[model samples]
Target: MTVGEVMSKDPVSIREDDYMTHARQVIRDNFLRVLPVVDEGNRVLGVLSDQDVLNIRSSKSNVTVRGYIRETPLITPDMDLLRAARELLDAKQHHAPVVSSSLDRSIVGILSDVDLLRHIQPTKRSPASVEEIMTAKVETAYPDDSISRIWDNMLHWDYTGIPVVSHKKEPMGIVTRIDIIKAGYARIGTANMHGRSSGGSMRVEKVMSTPLYSVAPESSISEAIGEILRNDIGRISVTDGGRLVGIADRHDLLRACLEGTGL
Candidate 1:
């Protein structure tokens, strides 16, 4: 399939002159990996990933998106699916702004890893287990752990989600960057009044998402993909006999796809 066949058209985008506060809110609310930055003429300038917004500090001033705009592999609607996916992977970008052409920067659509994963069936090429692609060295959080601590860990390690485990090391819930961006964005005096403060007093259990989504380490890569797509989540916990083992995310799945299909 071609990129145009699966790419999301008229994707959510932000103007170059828009404030970072607004950009951060848009990413938080849309659950987007990257937001296209465009000019007044609707020409693509670049993109702002979730990581970029996570760096936004809750200070007295707000910055415009222009300064934070990042360059990404420019994708065109007519490009091959795998080729486009390769460009994204090569550039270390999860998504990119689809343009009319290399010369014409007019934004056309947006293509993400999720969009391509739906078309490429890795099972058809190679029957690899989730364990082969999962990140074994996983990071986790305890329910009793302070939200402040978890937030610091996520920023330090650049983790989008951290599994919340019980004292017995069993998965209980999950805490994600979005969770912190919502529950802990405010660290000033007003955060105390809002009750969602990221201060040491707030516990991870309070902000962590319950009913953890997980799959067995030995599960097929196809099964892992299904779970991720079903939940519309970035990553899923990998367990072994009810114990937290690893993590399988879109990046891992797509990397496996490229290797398996030799795309």
Candidate 2:
């Protein structure tokens, strides 16, 4: 199959002249890691990813979207879908725009790792357990930890969310960037910048999403993939007897698809 077959058509785009803050808000609200940057005529300029926004915040820059544009490998609709997934993986990005042409810059659609997951066809080479693709180096936060600690971890590590655990390291909930941003908006929190408490009212437990979606370490990739799609979540924890062991997200699924392994 080709990229156009599974690509998200008519993707949301932003102008080059738009503000970085606006791009951040757009990403936060849309739950996207990357946004296609286009000209007034819908010509592709480049892409602004979550990394770009994070880098801007870290540097305390005033750069606009235009300044933040990073060169992206051109993706045309006719390319083999697997190749497209590989390109995205090599770029260390979760998605990319499908354009009419590299020189022309008209984006026809977008392809994400999640889109690639839908294309995965199980093969004999596929592994039977989720362990192969799961990320074992998890950065967890405690429920009692201050919200500022969670914010620092996310900022420095680019964690989409951190599993909330107890002193015994048993999973309790999950704290995400969205939750922190919402708290910041409500409390007018300056803790993210100042590295202080959000007036001591906010805690990791307060913002964490409880009753998390999870899977067992020995679960099949097919089963994990099904859960991910069904729940529409970016990631799911891999537990062994109810303790967090690893995480499998869109990237893991993409790896399985491309390798035709770890089903």
Candidate 3:
């Protein structure tokens, strides 16, 4: 499939002149994590994401919205979906602006990781087992670990989530960036009202997502992809029965596809 097939046409966008507050409101109202910036002629200029907005807020900068504008990764409408998806994953970008090949580089649509996964789902061929694609070096966390420490680990590793494991090496649960953010709010609220540090003494068990989504090592690659897509997650832990073994991420699937197609 080509990018044009899966991209959202006429995506929502903002002008450089728009206020930061307006951009934040647009994201909230639309439930969007990224927004494109365009010129008056509807040509692609830049893009903005939740992370960029958060960084700006944290800096406490007095700069205008123009200063927050970001240069976005560009993809042609005719590009192969798989290739486009791989580029986005490699860049760690959630969205890319689809532009016309013509002189103007006119904004045509937007391609997101979610859209690429949807396209790959039905065409996926089952491999013999998850062991064929799973990466054995998996990052993990302990249940007793504090939220502050967990956040530091996540940031250091650039991980979206980490599996919580017991002393015996059995998976207990999973803790994600979203979970930590929620916990941060809870921590601040408690600390301000109760004069205590929520993160200083609290444990990962109190905030981690339980009933972790797991896949058996012997499962087919197609089946594993389906599971990851179903969960709307970036990675999945591979296990043998109940023992942690490896992991399968979006890049693994892309690499498999590229090798299979000799791309």
Candidate 4:
């Protein structure tokens, strides 16, 4: 189907002149991970996501939001939703801005991967359970593990996030790339670069985000999608009675769509 058929019209956007703090709030309030950067005339300028805002905040940079504006990926209104989805996946972007070519690249709508999935998949069918698609070999971290070691593990595994587990092997929390980025920002801001190595030497239990959100193995794909959307998160850990089992991510869901549609 055409992008216009599924693109969210008149999406909540931010101006180039706005502040990073404002952008952060806008994203959180709207349950959005990305926002289109627009001009006074609603022309598309660029796009920003939670990671960008977090990076800015993490850096403790004094620059305004406009300073962060650069060339953002764009798609024409008439583009196919599947093509657009593929572009987003390739770019690892959560949202894409849809502009009208006849209107001087004027922002007309915003397309998100979730929207594309909804359009391409039949939601009414029996929802696929998480156990059926989740990656069973989950990478995990120990609570007492040093952050430095954990960071090494993350880089070695090329993981965006890793679950923190207790000595009993129970899921305790989660540590994400964003979290490490924030920690690095904090370290730089505090002039504690040397101290960071020592800091990173500390246990991950000190910084990992606890009370993680998760899904059960039997839960339907619909439920998983809803949780991902409602939480504005990129990944979800699957559990069976408080024990970590598998992991599901946006890529997994998209792959399922592609395979099911024979694309």
The TM-scores of all predictions, comma-separated, are 0.88, 0.86, 0.75, 0.61
Residue runs of model 3 more than 4 Å from their true location after superposition: 9-42, 47-59, 63-72, 89-92, 121-128, 182-202
Candidate 1 residue lDDT tens string, 172-255: 989987776676542433353135444456788878898789998789888888998998788988988888888988888887
Candidate 4 lDDT tens digits, 42-135 = 8988887665564442433345578776565668778876667767777677688888974577988888777876666533333368788899
* Candidate 3 C-alpha lDDT tens digits along 77-149: 8898877876786666778889997466789999987677767642344356778888898888899877666
**How do the residues 170-221 of candidate 2 rate in per-residue lDDT, one tens digit apiece?**
8887887776666553122343434545556357787788877899988988
Global Cα lDDT for candidate 3: 0.72
Tally clashing residue pairs in candidate 1.
0
Per-model lDDT: 0.81, 0.78, 0.72, 0.71
Error of 4 at 247 (Å): 1.3
Model 4 lDDT, full chain set = 0.71
> In model 3, what is the error at residue 219, expressed in angstroms?
1.8
Candidate 2 lDDT (Cα, 0 to 1): 0.78
**Considering every candidate listed, which one attains the maximal TM-score?**
1
lDDT at residue 158 of model 1 (Cα atoms): 70
Residue pairs with colliding backbones in model 2 are 44-105, 126-261, 127-262, 127-263, 221-263
The lowest-lDDT stretch of 10 consecutive residues in candidate 1 is: 185-194
Highest lDDT scorer: 1
- The predicted structure with the larger TM-score, 3 or 4, is 3
